[model samples]
Target chain A: MSPAEIQQSQNNQLKFLDKPLQADATTDIIYMMCPMHLLTIEEQVREIKAGQVLSILTDYDGALDDIPAWCRKTGNEFLGIYEDTDHYKFYIRKKAPDNKQNV
Target chain B: MKTIYMDHVATNPLHPEVLDAMMPYFREIFGNPQSIYEPGIRAKEAVENARASTAALINAKPKEIIFTSSGAEANNFALKGIAYASRNKGTHIIVSKIEHHSVLNPARFLEKSGFAVTYVPVDKYGTVDPDDVKKAITKETILISVIHASPEIGTIQPVDEIGRIAAEKGIVFHVDAVASAGNIPVDVRSLNVDLLTFAAHQFYGPKGAGALYVKEGTRIVPLIYGGIQEGGRRAGTENVPAIVGMGKAAEIAKRDMQKRIEHVTPLRDRIIDSALKIDKVTLTGHPERRLPGHASFVVEYIEGEAMLLLLAGKGIYSASGSACSSKALKASPVLISIGIPAHLAQGSVVFTLGEGTTGEDIDYFNETFPQVIGRLREISPYAKGWEGAEDPTCTVKK
Candidate 1:
């Protein structure tokens, strides 16, 4: 997505956090060690495909804000964010505008 | 949690005397300094009293000092204000690459606005060579800014020498003495600087309190133009309590500067000695010319954040020059510029001994530190998984 679209989607994601969340079993878990400024949405979106829940643990503030916005903009579910001592646990589920036909 | 503060260079706890002096201003004399009423007059006097004390610490006249919200603002005023003031005189500014972001950022801002900036490189000791300063100066060079002492590496620049060059060339010189003032002697007249910056918190004063010393007859435009406050140089309602605290802190610092050097030096020596005992450790900055309270080291292989966390677990506070702890996870430019390799810079740790720090605290740190490093190293991922068991891909171990 263009920088402006990504920004608009990010604005929507912060707004989405104020809304309710839903959870499911098809969630994929991963640890993203890169700091937020270095991490890109394209890099994250490429992994989960469409219609899969993604759980990410990251300490970077940019990632905390960016991932939720990316999820909302791409028509995915941002389930919720949880906190740990060293990192924040973010749960995002992908929604299929274009499913790769995975289970 | 155990309280062991090794982060004085970041910000210091307020001196008790400073806190006591500021207490009455919080409630009793809460009137604005700009008001014409009796309370206003009293408040104004309090601010002037602070101005006097802060000025006296640096041997400047009271009228020369401008109260700023923080040292960063003072830095902005010093760099940008002078650049704006001397627009027709010249547009080139020279600064050391290791300056605090406050100084460096303003210089960059001036660059964007058509002013030319030359970032002079530092020697491996992080000390700026006066000869380089002499070489960098050109016909268009209007200003030279260098920190009086670096907080990151604790290398005090030779501002007195640099000031002489700037004066000789008829260019304005500004020095950021935020980290140097409370710990060392910073006489503005002796230094021959056009402008000097100080933050109270660096010297055990309250946060939100800072001062800029502009030498008399120095023509610099005000960054903030509004009210007739700060002698109309900086126009804002003064931070009265913080200003009062800063005054008391400055007064105490001046009175006890020598004694402070006597107290913190031995502990600083011990911390540096103990950290050096660990294998593959290298110290940063000038060995002899560094701040009396500072001891910085880079422990190779392990990341600084992991070591910091492990140290924090034992309640021994420390700061890192490491990239992992930074917002962008980038190695400190100061460390890199000082000739520490990027891989080595990742393990940088800084320990600053404060007024409250004692030999006993140093002992506790020394006793706990080796274990902290060992534990972190065992899990470092760069080190071997187990004894005699190593992967061919583990280049760090190799």
Candidate 2:
């Protein structure tokens, strides 16, 4: 895809990520173009749901380490990170005793 | 403690000579410049002498210089003052898209005041086309203001050519030289500009110090109203110490203009040449025409704040990205204007070298930066699956 087209698709995926999400859904995703350095961990924590399997897409930044550490602290499982042309798609299974969905 | 400062475009540390010149104004030379007393006379003479020195640096006469609180303030005075005074002549003004916030904000304010403004666009190298400028002028267009140099991208505008166009059209022209004044030679007469703006702190003078040069015949309404000061053009108690320091800074700049350019240009080139060896990093400004001490670039798969923070941790100081105000981290207008994808624009970093910058400093940065990038990229969502991604380069002027 063209770079602009790639960005558009990335943005479309990000829009999908920000939807009114549910923890019961199999997997929901978000593309966060905002830099983690500009954000506090508290801000990052607030973006998560307790029992959701989420894929948060962000650019190259501290969020890679930060999100995993947040997952570790809250007992969530980081499903590992995936990359496309210009963005990173991070997958995580939110912390819940009964949460098991991963992709 | 050794700290490498590469953010000189934002502000210059006060030169020791400037400080030495200013010290007496705070102590033995303390006097209200308006008073008739000996101390006051001396103070007034100092202020006038400083005005002469500042005027000399820009090839303006002493009568043309009006001291102000800062470059931003000088910009406001030039734009708004001209707008209000020339409203009867015309309500139209033109400025470029890549001007500093000071110029952009005042233009915006004018828009709300029944004045019409056309924002001229720049090319991929952050340059305004003189032909585009000539095309934008209307019969009602009374003024045109363009920046001499863009701090975010280190792009120097064609000021002399733009000045020629303005002179032919009989429109008042203003150049914001805050970014170019000390690091390069800016001769007002040669540029043929009617008004110009500059800040002291951009050239190793104190903060809250700036100057506006108004040509003899051009009329502008005063931005401030009060007792007689600055020939009834700008009103306030003269900032004696800061103004004196600016004068000293101007004199030093004029004296060392060639020498300093020779010293800083090579260092700037070395940094740019070394940094570009990294993958997917593109230089943002004009390669040949940029300021002597200025360099800028946008790196793929990274954001500016992260890069800046990492660089800072290594004892290097610089700026990342451009925001209109401190609150916004949105993609920079300058970068976007240059046709970089909005997402890629966030990766912008600006490095402005100055007097104390050294080769060893650039070496340390060159060595440390890639490691930090590697560390950050390893965890980056963008880089995670970025193997074999399409070329991020857009149709930018190289």
Candidate 3:
């Protein structure tokens, strides 16, 4: 099942992680807003191989909703978010090529 | 009467190619880049293409450039954005005394907001010493901004050395390259600068277009925070036509910079050599290490405005100090900072060359300028000497 379908079945409860997830790559978009958060994720996700996690750091409050929504839309797995002191670190694992949604 | 424009530093006429590139965007291609439709997509493509060209001129990545309205706006953004973004890391900032008011005013504003700012001193030639920059650093130093060159004096600072010092301490370094970026080769990597400010008009592009080069991974708070434009760092409907013109200008500047420099340097040298022949006309800024197209000096007996008007009458237009300081009729802070007495500072005159500047134009100026000074000095009471004039506190070396 795609991440969106699993998220729907789980009643849309956001998965909050206790410890930050290990990721193959990281990007910081702190203080950047709106589509940048989503656009950066889309761009970074394509670089990592299937099953490799990509971590994004941002301070924009909107990312809390947009990132997970983007994961659901793109069929990528959202590992969860790690709350930093000033910003949030979001982790997402790239889906296998067969299941990856066309960008 | 022939009009000889000697104020390239003030601004430049748009190149024919740049105007041609911008023509379409003013009417038919007028779509919002944020829109999703076909016209909007086309507009977005134009903006991105411009971004690439602008970035290419500076050897920066396309994503690193943020479009702004003018060089002043970019200067303000660099100072305030970095100051606020790095506030949590520290509260102290360092800037040179010779910075443009755009940078200086913002630093002053930051000072009022509880940040400690140290305005570093400059040498008599208006050049900042990198060792002084090193000495001013504190554990709380978060950012250091210095001008790449003085628009008023045309003195180029040792930004590469200052940038290296900033890097050694892991501090964010910003350079106000509005005066020097396209006029000279400015490589962010080679200079070790984290952010740089430049304007299109300084390179024969439209007046309204400018850019800030924010190196990748250098986090900065947005100066204008409404929309998602400029990757969410600067927000407003894009000035599509102006930005397009700037891109074309940048491309042309990159291709023709060496030729332009070669053409202007000799003409500039002639102006400086001729002007310095008149007694009491002292050169400002570093003689050999200055902008290739710049010639600036202080005429002892005549006021700069008087020289400007008399020269304008003779069809040779020039400026006195910066556009702002000249109009204020006060001694230019840059002159005062460099230890020129206030009386001498009033006589500051600047002549900058451009692509259109010709040998004939320089010859005309060379003959006319001395005549205008002579005329101003003849009618002046102090032409003989400043009998009761305030002490000539000038620290300039003979």
Candidate that scores best on DockQ? 3
Q: In candidate 3, which residue pairs get closer than 3 Å at backbone N, Cα or C atoms, i.e. clash?
A: none
First chain TM-score, candidate 3:
0.86
Q: Identify the leading candidate in terms of TM-score.
A: 3
Residues B1-398 of candidate 1 have per-residue lDDT tens digits of 66698988888998888899999899899989989999899999999999999999999999889999999999999999899877777899999988888888898899999999999999999999999999999989999999988887889899999999999999999999988998999999989899999999988899999999999768667788666677556877888999999999999999999999999999999988888898877888889999999998888768788888888889888889633235455667788778776666777888888889977788899999889888888877677523443222211110
Docking band of candidate 2: incorrect
Error of 2 at A95 (Å): 95
Judging by lDDT against the true structure, name the best candidate.
Answer: 3
Judged by whole-model lDDT over C-alpha atoms, candidate 1 comes out at 0.80
Candidate 3: lDDT of B253?
A: 92
Query: Which residue pairs in model 2 clash with each other?
Result: A17-A29, A17-A30, A83-B385, A88-B381, A88-B382
Displacement of the residue B40 alpha carbon in candidate 1, Å: 0.5
Stretches > 4 Å off in candidate 2: A1-103, B325-327, B384-398
- After superposition, the stretches of candidate 3 with alpha carbons farther than 4 Å from their true spots are A1-12, A97-103, B390-398
Instruction: Rank the models by lDDT, top first.
Output: 3, 2, 1
Share of native interface contacts recovered by each model: 0.00, 0.00, 0.83
Interface RMSD of 1: 22.5
